[model samples]
Target: MSVTDKDRDILTRTLWGEARGEGLAGQIAVGWTIRNRVDDGKANSWWGESYAGVCQRPYQFSCWNKSDPNYAYLSGAKPIPPREFAQAQIAADQVMAGMVQDPTRGATHYYATSMPKPPVWVKGAKETLRLGHHIFFSDVP
Candidate 1:
């Protein structure tokens, strides 16, 4: 699917909200996870139809959630720090353009290791990779 400018902006903001502190690799990993969701076919259409759709899909990535702590910054109500935003943009650009490898393998799911407990869905899923604070997974069935 073709990506529009709005899609790129939303994707970059999402990377900024979700993984900006984890640096470039972390941002790229998050981007790949969203792309994986987009490519996941009809089985996961609720994850959305494009980069923007996936990133903005309700309750999937919490940063876009209304109650999420990062909402203000991610939504532009509060500005992201310039350098961090730039780094996230770079990560988003590379991933969206298919210029980088899928560092999380084929992971379509992840949760920050910082979570008090792994989500129930993680059970029996194939563990993919750990990048920064998040643990990636796939093949949950």
Candidate 2:
């Protein structure tokens, strides 16, 4: 799949919002999860038809949710630290260019392990990877 400048920008912001504290490897894992979502044949239409679509899709990536703590930064109402934004951009470029293999191993879903309760959807899904604070899953039915 080819990534447009818009797609790269959206993905970079998403990495900044979702995985900024998790460092480069964490950002890459998050990027692959988004790519996996874009590639999932069975995802609901609201899940998105493109990178921007998915990342901005309501109620999907919580960082875009109005109530989410990261919304202000993600929505451009606040600035992301220059260093963090630069790191996220690097992660986005690598993934969009396929310069590094997917570290999530086809995972389309993930949640921070720090969440007190795992989402109900994880029940029957296969756990595919754990990097930083996130746990990734696939083969959901």
Name the top TM-score candidate.
1
**Backbone collisions counted per model:** 0, 0
Worst 10 residues of 2 by lDDT: 38-47
- Runs of candidate 1 exceeding 4 Å displacement: none
As a TM-score, model 1 comes out at 0.95
For all predicted structures, in order, the TM-scores are: 0.95, 0.93
Q: Write the per-residue lDDT of candidate 1 for residues 22-137, one digit (tens) a residue.
A: 99999999999999998887864878989999999887899999898899998889989999899999999999999999998999998998899999999999999998899999
Q: Candidate 2 clash total?
A: 0
Let me know the TM-score candidate 2 reaches against the reference structure: 0.93
Model 1: how far is 136 from its true place, Å? 0.3
Candidate 2 lDDT for residue 64: 87
